[model samples]
Target: MTIKLLAIGKTDNKLLASLITDYQNRLGHYIKFEFEIIPDLKKVKHLSETQQKEKEGALILSKLAATDTLILLDEKGKQMHSIAFSEYLQKYMNSGIKQLVFVIGGPYGFSEAVYNKAQGMLSLSKMTFSHQMIRLFIVEQFYRAFTILKNEPYHHR
Candidate 1:
């Protein structure tokens, strides 16, 4: 199965972008991985939070395929340890899915429509994180999960 990460906005910090790229490359060795960025909305000052979420939700939904399993990285999502996350990945792999898509929403988070479409939600941490930073964390975790699954030395190192 191909794992895809769809996040709002581009990673602007050079350091964060580099780290995300490194993890993405590492993950490619185990499974097909794709990272996509949905451009930030323009003229945000004119729109309400709900409107922004609705618009972002539309963009997020547009990137999906009919068969893709949507997973949202949400604050209220189910939290799991790295090992358990590895098991989670294994479960999906065994299920014979073509694409598993995880989304990192914009500043206002996801809309009701986006929430309704998701198959599951996962929380990386209880504390909040910047959208750009979450991109790095999620990719690194994906790399870590794959290493754990393959019994690679990287996880312990």
Candidate 2:
């Protein structure tokens, strides 16, 4: 299955962008991966948090394919260790999905509609992380998970 990561907004930090690129390149060897960045909403000062979430939610939904399996990287989602996460990836690959999309929502988080559309949710950590940083973290984890699955030395117990 092809894996896609959809995140709202651009990564402004040069260092973070480079790191994300590095991991993206590494992840490509194991699976088809695409990282799509939705442009940040403009004039956010005029919109309330709810309005922003609703607008962002619509944009997020627009990027999804009807048959895609959506998974949100949410704070309240299920948290798993590295090995378990690797197993989760194995399960998804075995499920014969067309595409697996993992989304990192806007600053305020996902709207109810986005939540309802998701097949599942995953939490990388209990602690909060910036949206840009999460991109790198998730990509790196994808690489690590693949390495683990292949019995490579890139990941250790």
Candidate 3:
């Protein structure tokens, strides 16, 4: 199955972009991975938080297919160890899915519509992280999970 990461906005920080790119390259060695960014909304000064979320939700929903399993990276979502995450990936692949889509919502988080569409949610840590940083973390974790699945030496535990 192909894995896709859908996130809001682009990472302008060069250091973070470099790190994210490195992990993306490493992950490509294991599975088909794609990272798509939804451009940030313009003129946010006038829009309310709810309005922003609704607009962003529309964009997120537009990118999904009927059969796609939507997973949101949320703070209140399920947390799993690296090995468990690998098994999770294995399970999805075994199910013969065409694509597994993971999403990182906007600054105010996801709208009610986006939440309703998601099949599952996962959290990388208890600590809050910037949206840009989460991109790096998730990609690295994907690489780590694949390496662990292959019995590679990348992960120590």
lDDT of each: 0.96, 0.96, 0.96
- Runs with alpha carbons beyond 4 Å of true place in candidate 2: none
RMSD of each: 1.0, 0.6, 0.7
Cα lDDT tens digits for candidate 3, 1-157:
8899999999989999999999999998999999999999999889999999999999999999899999999998999999999999989989999999999999999999999999999999999999999999999999999999999999998
12-127 in candidate 1: lDDT tens per residue? 99999999999998898999999999999999999999999999999999999999999999999999999999999999999999999999999999999999999999999999
As a TM-score, model 1 comes out at 0.98
TM-score quality measure for candidate 2:
0.98
Poorest 10 consecutive residues of model 3 by lDDT? Answer: 89-98
TM-score of each: 0.98, 0.98, 0.98
Candidates ranked, most accurate by TM-score first: 2, 1, 3
Off by over 4 Å in 3: none
